[model samples]
Target: MIKLSGVIITFNEERNIEKCLQSLVNVVDEIVVVDSFSTDNTKRICLKYNVKFIEQKFLGYIEQKNFALGHASNNVIVSLDGDEALSEELQESIITLKSNWQFDGYYCNRFNNFCGQWIKHSDWYPNKKLRVFDKRFAEWKGINPHDEIVLKDHRKAGKLKGDILHWTYQSYSEFNAKTEYFSTIAAQAYFEKGKKAPFYKLIWNPFWAFFKAYFLRLGFLDGNNGYIISKETGKITYLKYKKLRKLYSNN
Candidate 1:
């Protein structure tokens, strides 16, 4: 059987770290947590479990994740965020996969819990993430706030049944706060890549974001939570482009 090493990056994740660690107890042979020196009880909680806790400087999302990957003792890795945990079915599927170890990587659907609601739509459900993989074949890539694992070659990938339960936000205020922070990072990333956002995009892109999430994606099926998500999605779009425009104008 292949031994799996679980890795995660954390910063002030006291509220979610325990749950995240507990879920990995049965699935992974070892757990490694790379924290950005959280001032909260994150380290204390991590000590409760048999985890190798390393305090590192605050690197961007993609960089931090790659750093965490380096601490793993095994090449077969199960990477997760501090706010995410494997569902029971996913744990079982992973356990079985470890016994057989067929594909180079495994992708699983993530179901996000937003403000106490298990969002079924709003482009949230079936949020496919390639979290489990062989470190030799993949690396974390993409923008700051949104990082994904990219395979080095045309490696074989497989899907697993079940979800990665993502405890996204506890309140609307938290959602907004994250949006503000993430939008800033996204704009900076875009600006660095020589991407520009004009006035028309500032106006039309947000409208299209709302329409696509709320209408085309069938977000309405989630009721009030759907509306809030769709609205926030549009707001984030506006913020990203607006910030991008400001960045270019200032230079």
Candidate 2:
């Protein structure tokens, strides 16, 4: 079997870190948590586990993730967020993959939990992410709040069954707070890349965002949780462009 290393970048993730690590406990040969000097008890929790905890300055998301990758002891990397955990079936699939090692990376569907309910629609379910990858084949790329694993060649991609359970929000307050922070990063990232959304998108996108998520995507099936998800999605879109407009006006 191929030995695997788990890597994660975190800051003030005290509530989720333990659960995240717990899900990874048996699957990884080594676990490394690169923290950005969290003021909370995040460090204390990581220290309790067999994880190798390292403190680092917070760069942007992509840079911080790449930094953590560099510190991984193995080339077979399972990159997880501090807020995400593997499901039992997914864990089993990964263990099987380690033995076979067929592809350069494995993409998994992440099922997000928002406000204590599992979101199945609204462009939320099967939110594909390439979390398990060979370090030599792929590198973290893209801007803050939207980084992705960019593979040198697309041939090295595979898929896994079962979802990666993402404990996205402990409370609505947390969700709102994070959206504000992420919107800032996203806007700055877009500004730096010379990408600009037209004025129509500033208004129309939020409406379409709700329409696509709620009606078209059958978010109504999810009931109240779906409504909340759609509401937040619209807010994020509004904030992203609002910040972008700020950048444009300032410049």
Clashing pairs in 1: none
Q: Which pairs clash in model 2? A: none
User: Which segments of candidate 2 are over 4 A away from where they belong?
Assistant: none
For every model shown, what is its TM-score relative to the native structure? 0.98, 0.96
Whole-model lDDT per candidate = 0.94, 0.90
Prediction-by-prediction clash tally: 0, 0
- For 1-251, candidate 2 gives per-residue lDDT tens digits of 88999999999998798989998999999999999999999999999999989999999899999999999999999999999999999999999997799888999999998888888888898799999999999999987878999898665799998789998887878888988989899999999999897898888988899889999988888998788778888888988999999899988
lDDT of 1 by residue, 212-243 (tens): 99999999999998999999999999999999
Best by TM-score: 1
Q: What is the lDDT of candidate 1?
A: 0.94
Best by lDDT: 1
Error of 1 at 150 (Å): 0.8
